[model samples]
Target: MVDADQTFVIVGGGLAGAKAAETLRAEGFTGRVILICDERDHPYERPPLSKGYLLGKEERESVFVHEPAWYAAHDIELHLGQTVDAIDRSAKTVRFGDDGTAVRYDKLLLATGAEPRRLDIPGTDLAGVHHLRRLAHAERLKHVLTNLGRDNGHLVIAGAGWIGLEVAAAAREYGAEVTVVHSGPTPLHSVLGPELGQLFAELHREHGVRFHFGARLTEITGQDGMVLAARTDDGEEHPAHDVLAAIGAAPRTHLAEAAGLEIADPAHGGGIVVDERLRTSDPDIHAAGDVVSFPHALFDTRLRVEHWANALNGGPAAARAMLGHDVTYDRVPYFFSDQYDLGMEYSGWAPPGSYDQVVIRGDAGKREFVAFWVKENRVLAGMNVNVWNVTDTIQRLIRGRARVNTEHLADPHIPLEDLAP
Candidate 1:
């Protein structure tokens, strides 16, 4: 049992940090817990920021991780608007805020999340340019989108990744003219590859969204500190009132790096390296969530997942490890996305060149199908689009590692459970 004198400090007021604090208490740890957040608001999930909240389908209160009273009732020392600038490893303390209040910890958990990658082009400092990563940015974007809808303004979004496509759908729903600029031929090319990425391209085109393929945003021209237009490398200029840089995010590892913790190389996705138990270079210092690069036994690789489910499960796993429990953080990677009427849940990892064949079950034309990435007759990963109640069976196939008949895998009539066994 942890003594009452022991203190556990978790940096970064995000879903992972908040959930870690909750797990400590649930597991009967009576040690002092200090959760510090840079933002003034409490910890909350980030998915809704780009999806429902941005679309106005969800309310402001729904985005929060817990009720305001839950933290105090549970005796969690919640510090908001205080950023940890440095970590004194030898002294075992962290100093923060304007006053430089120092807090000592027996164990330190780094859950500092990622920051959005900004466009390096000109006119990025313009008033009408926007990027969505935090609640505050979403709140400002919500107002910008609302005004654009009411005034019949056009919005040009850079990058055709998940964030870009989701925001495109939301903007279209709000009656704003939407155009996406991407260097790839289709959306989500880095994740879904060209085969499935083309499906999303068609989906958006049907919704009246324009796509500028094989080019990137070179410049954003503006007048009087407001956006006027976006110029592409292909020499095409798109007229716009507002611009959303829906580019991807980079992991926030400066604090971890400054503390002399070993960081993963760019090929490994650039994060703080952690073992299967989520232990960093310093045994007392652990890292989890998006900031961590953990070794996955199943995939035989070190993966740094920036998905919602990773944070939801990684936090509790790290908490248990901190309590000296036998923990192996080997949960299958899972993530879901909602665009228009389509909903998808992707399980396992299947990057390009990692899989040999992609078999489809059900009707792709109708937007209801299960696509499997197979390598040498074994299922590496599977994605269910507009198809429900098969994630369990799909994960079973991945974990089971049994050879599946390629013919049966593509047959909609054959049940997924039967093939795994």
Candidate 2:
């Protein structure tokens, strides 16, 4: 039986932290559960912030991970708008807020996620410049979109990653003129690489979105505390009623670093280092979500995934591990995105240099296809675009780690099931 007198503290109030608390209860751990969030709002998921919620299709209430009453009903102590300043490892306590109030814990979990990387450019503080990372940010952006929809305002977006592209799609739907500025050759260059990135670029172009590749904002020109235009390093100027900085996000790891936990190096994407069980260097403390960089034996490297699926699954996995259960979180990395009329689900990890060639199984022009990244005829990763119900077989092929026939993979009639066996 679990210790009912024990206290478990979870820091960060997002999907990961919320799910961890729920798992603790579900696993029959009758202990005091304290969940601390820097934001005043209850724990919520982040995907909707940039997608449905921002598009006005999803209500604000739907973004939350659970109903407001669920925490109290489950006997969880939920602290809101409270930032943990430090972790006192020696005393086994977490100090928070201006007064440095301490909360002692027998075991602790750090689910601190990531923060949007700010652009170091002039006029960023202007009224029309924004960043979308939280519920509040989306709220402001939604209002801006409504007004832009009515006024036909021009929105200049910096970066062409998922956030930038998603917001661009939303802006276009709102009847706003959208221009994306990206430093790479095409949109999603870091993730999809050039080939698939070009496909996205074409998709956005067909939706009337303009692309300014090989450029980044050198300055944001404004008048009367309102954005007017953005000037790029390539000496091109684009008119802008509003500007969005969606460059990227960095893991929030100050507390973990100050507490002297093992941190992954910057080159490998810095994050709090954890084992396969999501256990940190300190045996009493574990970590999950974007803040966690753990060993993936399957990939033969350490990875820190910031996608929604990571937090959705990692939290419960960590919670079970904290409860002294045998847990090996080797789930293959997965993420999906919706843009315009096209939707895609990608499984496994394949960066630009990691795979030798890409094989296509369907019509790329129709935007209905399955693409696989192969290295020496072994499937490293697969993505299904505007295709459905093959995630299971695709994941099995990845986990199989055996050589696959490129002809079978490229043939649409050859079922994905056949490739696995």
Candidate 3:
């Protein structure tokens, strides 16, 4: 039980921070909690920003996790638009901006999250090029799409990941000419592997979105206050009116590092270093969400997973640990992406270059399939396209370490439930 006056300072008011504060209250912690967010608005859903928000299918108010009044009702001090400039670990206080007002905390949760990586090419500062990460970024892009008109407008996306593809689908729906430039051979190769990556390449091509596979971008050129063309290393030039660089995101670790907190290397390519209980090097501080780098039980190595489910799960896990109920944060990792009338879902952990066999269930040609990644007679991971229901069963089998027969796995006649342990 926490003392009624114990102050819990939570940095970053995104999904992880918001969820952690809510979980603290649910866990019977009647403490003075302060949530500091650089953004003025309340926490909003980011997933919709790339799809529905871009299409204007969702409103800003609708995307907010909770209304401003809800924070007051929960006795949470919502400090919006205030950036924490530095941390004084010796004094256990956080100093923000020129205001010099210091916030002291008995416990601190760093959910600082990450920001979208920007293209370091020429003309990147042009008015037409954008990167979507926050609600503001999405709103700006939405305004551009509405005012500029997508009909006959050329949209060039610099990365072929989920965000890039989703934005492409939305832009294409608006009758815009879309082109995806990927340095890799295909789309989502790092996550979905080569076979499914090629399938996505075909799917996007069928939708009138041109793809430049294995093409490296050298520079983004602009003229007369607008983006003109993107130059590639292979001497291929793509004319563009608007450009979006969706390369990826790097962990926001400046604050943590400035506070003298130890950070994990990007060798695992994730974020902050954390233990099973989500505790960072500084025992008083805990981290979760995309900013955390922790060891994976399934992969027997450290991994940094960026997914909505991870933020939701990890936030509460850190809260429990802070409340003195330490539990191992071990669960099958899961992620989902909705693109062009198709649902893509993945579960479990797959080590790089370790899979020896793959079992294809259902028909890939029909765009409905589940691919099982197998190694040493054990299922490592599963990717389901347009088949969400099978994810739960697959996750269960993977968690139980079930050895499924390849013959039955490849047959569409066999139900997934029968293979469950």
> Which lDDT values do the candidates have, in the order given?
0.92, 0.93, 0.85
TM-scores for all predictions: 0.98, 0.99, 0.97
Q: What is the TM-score (0 to 1) of candidate 2?
A: 0.99
Number of the top lDDT candidate: 2
- Cα lDDT tens digits, model 1, 271-299, are 99999999999998989899999999888
- Please list all clashing residue pairs in model 3, or write none if there are none: none
lDDT of 3 by residue, 215-308 (tens): 8678889888789888888999999889999999999999998887878877668578888899888888999988988877867877787778
Instruction: Name the runs in model 2 displaced over 4 angstroms.
Output: none
What is the alpha-carbon lDDT for the whole of candidate 1? Answer: 0.92
Candidate 2 Cα lDDT to native: 0.93
Candidate that beats the other on lDDT, 1 or 2, i.e. the better one:
2
